[model samples]
Target chain A: MAGSDCLAANDWICGEYVRSRSQELTDATLQHLWITGASVAIGLLLAFPLALVARRWRPAAGPVLGFTTVLYTVPSLAMYSLLLPVFGVSAAVVVTGLVLYSLTILVRNILAGLEAVPEDAREAARGMGYGPLRLLFGVELPLALPAVMAGLRIATVSAVSLTTVGAIVGYGGLGNLIYEGMNSLFKAQVLTASAICVVLAIAADLLLLGVQRLLTPWTRGRTNARAARRIRIRARKAAV
Target chain B: MGAVSGAWTWLATGAHWAGGDGVWHRLGEHLYLTVVCLAISCAIALPLGLLLGHLGRGGALAINISNAGRAVPTFAVLVLLVLSPLGRYGQWPTIIALVLFAIPPLLTNAYVGMREVDRDVVESARGMGMTGGQLLARVELPLAFPLIMTGVRTAAVQVVATATLAALPGGGGLGRLITAGFNRYDTAQVVAGALLVAVLALLVEGAFVALSRLTDPLRHRRRARRQSVNSRGLPKRWVTE
Candidate 1:
């Protein structure tokens, strides 16, 4: 069986698996970046404006959000199928689906962040002679940045994972490597693809975490201090 | 399968399915595949999660393991597993891969839910002459139920969506229609598949939302006004009501 063979053939790449396809890996990574990068950019562009409009008019928020949630549930493969006739099996369909998938998280979070702006802050802003646009840009947006960032983080991770599925439609990505590896029973290739994916996922997660901490300075310090205080209190109680 | 057959029959001769035979047959298989995979996943994950949660040891490691599980692509895993002596393909490999896919969310939520309950509540229960078992059964379990339900809802939607991959390996389902639509460049069949999946997701989400309300009495009163209006065919009034 290939499972046992994969384990026994410690020198997997050296044996029949010595397929020097490094170019394929590089091409796949580039395709993945473009696909994900474009999707997130498009999602943010649409979601931010809609989120702003929805916040100013409370009635619009719920329906817009509900529509996006349904869009989120629409499967990637199905989305491709739906778009195939008009767009054909190109990168356009893949990116469009990814963008649609990003909306639910981005919109929901943006709305949540805006709403979380304490009413008193807005009142204070108005008292200070700030206009609606200025109040949102200066006060509400900054306060909501953490939540918005959190949503973006979730969207980014989701996009990365979903991009793998896009490879099935002849769009090259790390997933193509995995698919090829599996088909040929090439352990090294499969492992290589999976490792790159894991590293990418972790690197993205840690990068987002760092960005979140940096942007939400007050939140980071307070949370870390609170955690430290809890640990200290528990340690003292245990010692007593 | 029903969707595919409908698309196929429509392609052959744009005709209505007679006696609903094709629809029921296709729906039955799709539902069967979904149910079996979910059941298998729950069987493995539920108790494992509960045990790990109650112990509160290895929390980070368990979560990280599940996170890695989440990171692995389900379809890729299927392809890999299928290549082995598990050389068997189709629904079985799909089921196995989906089960693995579902475990992380289920375990993570279950663990976090029970672990994050108010320590003071546990202490109070203990002081009131309750054993750990009693405390868990009456307090911890009830409190964690909502969070666990969220995980279940997430897993259910994910399973239904991913189970379509079974069609890739020769098993039949609505995904077959979608995949076939892609291969043959048939737009309507693809639309049919996408629409069905979207509808299925909404229905499941609605069902779970109702179930969550029924299980939690506190939410019942707050959600009742909305549910009653919905049942009365007045979705417009439901949110405001």
Candidate 2:
């Protein structure tokens, strides 16, 4: 009787338990936005200046970026630990680490984008005697903006996922709730965190998609085709 | 270099890295966990990637799903699954998360590789009365192998690096040393852990470069010739003979 009761209890524990909870998820979503937003802003501030300097003196990029890649591969928590001694376990340390993480992705892509602009286009601008700064800002930078934006999209998404690690240092986000739920063995809290994070990710991605569309009108054609195909596939599945 | 020097010095010192609570042992465990998770993820990803590539359908869906996978935080998934009925903690959950992390690159690559194969070659193969399976196996796969290999290589590096995230749930990887260092306020331990992760990523990248070369011999031969010409003014064999 005892063994059977234990088995029954285990079975009950294994089943799905979905319930209503809106406020907690909303609060988490907002926190995620702020954390990731601040981190990306910090990253762009650091990386753009470095990229401009590297473009002026080409060899500098190799070593500067090599160092950044090493920093990039360091685990998020590990970077935080290395920072904690001097910086302490505050929002500053978390932001610093997150910002550094974005550098490797953004800087390299920025450099690549600048280099990828056709030589002819640059020569034509030079023929007009627009000067170095004008040529770079007017010709190269605008062309490179799409690639830079793509890199920013990737960095933003990466920041979203990684900012969760900040919760370990008492920086609250969706991840904090998830961690708390796990430690306390609260299944409801865990589910809420997981669902909130997923929803937030989707919302952020869609927002970025909208931004991409607004910036690059040509992207709309491709996106519309893909969306139509997806609708068709989903409708077919539903009908079946 | 100014920023890195302090961390590097702490890791180099013997007292900090060695002991009963040794940073080195933990580093080894961390690397071991990362390597195992990457291997498992690659094994799963490579086949599914190839299958999706072969079908030539669902490329957008695969990539979107992968982007979704990347966006969904690893720790969040770990908590939800590990705390639920799955309650299956440790390396398995870590591996699952790592696999989820790595799948996007592999799938995207395979799809691109297959799609990029010369249309004329495929048409000729079909016109020769070759069956679809035979055409794919004999012509398409070999031609697509180089591009597919590029994806696999990328996935390998990414998986190894991301595997550190596994340390959170007591999955026992290098990140554990980092966490321990944080708790103890020991910069040395943290530095050693961070260095090991960086070294591991570079090592994996180097190995994959060699693997890609071995798998695609023509590219390797061309690279060798280019290097020889750049270094010695001419091919040594041609010069000597």
Candidate 3:
């Protein structure tokens, strides 16, 4: 039955398909990458300080996180449409909405990472006459790198998918290919575009994983036990 | 300012509330799509995740599948299927796309939830002469309930938000409102549609929170009661409030 439709529909998946669509593919891929990158970058920039504030004032955590939750809960297409009156069909609208989407995860991860830093480490730093600022930058943030990287990986991958939804507004990366292909019933176009998007997402995730491994040498096999111990400590602290 | 008021007025008008294409009808379609997609995805992901987590194998595979799935945008999947033979039928393409979208969070969260249950607790349960099924039922599930619920909430919220895409294939939903507004060049109607979706998402979130509270057999964990016992008599009862 499926074959009946693709066959009768006059949509061919062939060599010429790849040749003719090269430029469109390249442009779409770039747009997708750029849009996804910008969302993650902006989300991280905003989430860092916001997370720190929530970390400092326990009371503000609920309201601040609640606001991000509301923002995130807005449907993707609706979020795009919600901003239509402001930015029209521009990439800014998608990026802005996605940044808001990314915040909930980013802020939560940043908060978790900061909290993961052992209290004893902080106390020891303080005992060594380190100021709050010094302790944060030199001690806590370094130890928190693995968790932060995990957040980055998640945000980037989700951004890739979210950017595709922006196609309804005419800026969705390879989404344009699928949209155009479906309209014309072009099987090759749809298949190729989906494959590429999948590749891009996996590549990005693996790249981030490598980066995480590189940055957090302590997370490697030798120092892995130390990391586990620190995690246990953080868990115990959370329980109390 | 103008857009907000215009949208409010547009929503207030009675014409938008009646007929097959009315807001109420579209809302039914939207809810139907969300619930169906969520139910199917959960059915597929929950058991597999729980089983793998219980056995402590295949976690990396499930997680990687979810992570890789992030790249296969639901829109692309929907349109591709819709263009193909499988899409020739009723709402299968739309349903399939939505199912794929819902799977990652549900699978990942459920898997992680199972794995994250305390090892010591499991050992203690085993030491107490409990069988695997008993340990899983009495100890593992209760401990994993919150995370599993969190995953369900994530999938449900996502399904609710993304169901707007079903309008593209002329399937049906609040998405019809959004696309129809765009086609008619009515920004106010578009704003109204988006607002309704946002409100709906929030409502779904609230419903899930309430659902979890009601069904969490392991927890009646206090939102209000934090008892601080003293060495002295009666523990000097006082509310954190």
Each candidate: RMSD? 6.9, 7.9, 6.2
Candidate 3 global lDDT = 0.84
User: Which tens-of-lDDT digit does each residue in A83-173 have in candidate 3?
Assistant: 9889977999899989998998899888899999999999999999999999999999988888898888888887887788787788888
Which pairs clash in the backbone of model 2?
Answer: B30-B173, B30-B174
Model 2 off-target regions past 4 Å?
A: A1-31, A118-131, A218-240, B1-32, B121-143, B184-187, B221-241
* Strongest candidate by lDDT: 3
**Candidate 1 local lDDT, A1-240, one digit each (tens):** 554464467333432332455577788888877887799889999999999888878899889988998787676766666555556668887888888899999999999998899999999999999998899889998899999988887787777777777765776377777767765677677766766776776677679889888877889778899999999999999999
lDDT per model, in order? 0.72, 0.72, 0.84
**TM-score of each model, in listed order:** 0.82, 0.76, 0.87
DockQ of 3: 0.68
Sort the predicted structures by DockQ, highest score first: 3, 1, 2
lDDT of 2 by residue, A1-240 (tens): 543443344332222322234566677667877888898888888888898888889889789898888687666766666566657667777788889999999898888889898999999999999899899888898777778887888888888888787777766477877777667676666666667666766677678767766776755686899999999999999999
On DockQ, the stronger of 2 and 3 is: 3
Which candidate do you rate higher for TM-score, 1 or 2? 1
TM-score of 3: 0.87
TM-score of chain A of 3: 0.87
Q: On residues B1-241, what C-alpha lDDT tens digit does candidate 1 reach at each position?
A: 4545554555454342222323334456667877887788778877777768877876996577665765566656666566555656445676777788877778888888889776766676688788878877876777678777877877777787777665554456567766666667666666666666667767877787789768873354335545664443322322353
Q: Candidate 1: what lDDT?
A: 0.72
Candidate 2 per-residue lDDT over residues B13-63, each given as its tens digit: 777667645667766775676567667766776767666777778788766
Candidate 1 residue B95 Cα shift, in angstroms, is 1.9
Worst 10 contiguous positions by lDDT, candidate 2 chain B: B230-239
